[model samples]
Target chain A: MKIIAVCGMGIGTSVLLKMNAEKVLRQLGIDATVDATSVAIARESRDAQIILTTPDLVDQLQGLPSEIVPIEHFFDLEEITAKLSASLL
Target chain B: MASPKQLSNYPALAKAFADNSIRVGAIALDREHAIEMAGELLVASGRSTPEYTQSMLDAVAENGPYIVIAPGIALAHGRPSEAVLEIGLSLVTLAEPVVFGSEANDPVRLVLGLCATDHNSHIDIMAELATVLGDAESVNTVLNAVDSDQIRLLF
Candidate 1:
């Protein structure tokens, strides 16, 4: 599975999201590749099966083929676990 | 399962904060001022040039307040640029929370400024940070820290 973790600049928070998501995926025994990118780039990623991002950026990414998962708290693993499990597992 | 304590989990981040990069109970008039204060610490630490500070502010202007990563925290940063000299971090805890215009996560009390010369250099530090910030109990401890020394002890 391919996933994209997106933030505005793609350097800071998205990287955090990507790393934590990878950790969660590993713990859950799910296999997936997560990429961190800017919203502009994420909009163009047609192959992404899931896109994890903050709740606010969800509107801008409207109509993308990937499942847009709105992450309210980027740092919270429990939240990430529940959200990702609901969507992926 | 219980969340692991943040003790000694972020050695690099602890060292970065030890280099006079942390300010506790600071006052900032607005979100911009808060971000500038965090960036200034990075500049003082020689991790980035003064221009990098403006780049961070510009990033907020262009991208909105997505930096407000959690309910009461903002991780201020811009892309790696010529202005960045090395990988570093600066932390500022505010006397009064400042709103960054995010409805979900507004009135940020903690601002963490990060600058890296490359994409991969700061990833580990950020990962450590994610763990530290993820737990509300840990976040509360940091938020209520009396001094920089107290904050340093957690890492």
Candidate 2:
């Protein structure tokens, strides 16, 4: 699976979200490659299967090509897992 | 992102916080004050310029498209611009939590400001910061830290 973790400027929170997404995907026995990028860049990304991001960016992702998963807390592993469990399959 | 294959740099981040990046036990009248103080720390360290600080405030006013990442924690930053002098991080632990107007998370206690020469440079820092912030115990330790020096030790 191709996943992209996105945020405003592509640096801080998105990196964290990407790390957690990859970790959760691995722990759930899923195989996926995740990319971290800015929301502007993420909008143009066509190949990603899932776009894991914060709630603030969910609206910006409207009409986009991927599944937009809005995470409430990027620091919570369990929350990321719970939100991603169904999507990975 | 910095490098997908690289491990998170907790130690280096710890050292960086110790040497050049922290302000703890601060009091802010509101979220903007908290953000400004956090941004100023980076500016004083030469990591960011005054315009970057103002931009941060503007971003928050624009409704924090990315600042509030978790409950009680907000990370403030802007696009890589001339406002940034170099890549740096600054942390502020507010004595009084202030609301940033998030439904799930509000009354933030920690405000982290990041400035990068480019977007990619701070991705590694974020990875490390996430490691520390991800753990509830560490976040608690950070909140309880007496000063900037102690917070660096916790990192």
Report model 2's chain A TM-score: 0.95
In order of listing, the candidates' clash counts read 0, 0
Superposing every Cα of model 1 onto the true structure, what RMSD results? 4.1
Model 2: per-residue Cα lDDT over A25-63, one tens digit each: 889989888888887898888888899988877888888
Q: Listing every candidate in turn, what is its Cα RMSD in Å to the true structure after a full C-alpha superposition?
A: 4.1, 4.8
Q: How much is B79 displaced in model 1, in angstroms? A: 0.8
Q: Please list all clashing residue pairs in model 1, or write none if there are none.
A: none
lDDT of 1 by residue, B25-90 (tens): 999999999999999999998889989999999988987888888898999998899999888889
All candidates: DockQ? 0.65, 0.55
> What's the true lDDT of residue A53 in model 2?
87
Error of 1 at A57 (Å): 1.7
| Number of the top lDDT candidate | 1
Q: What TM-scores do the predictions have? A: 0.92, 0.90
Best candidate (score: TM-score): 1
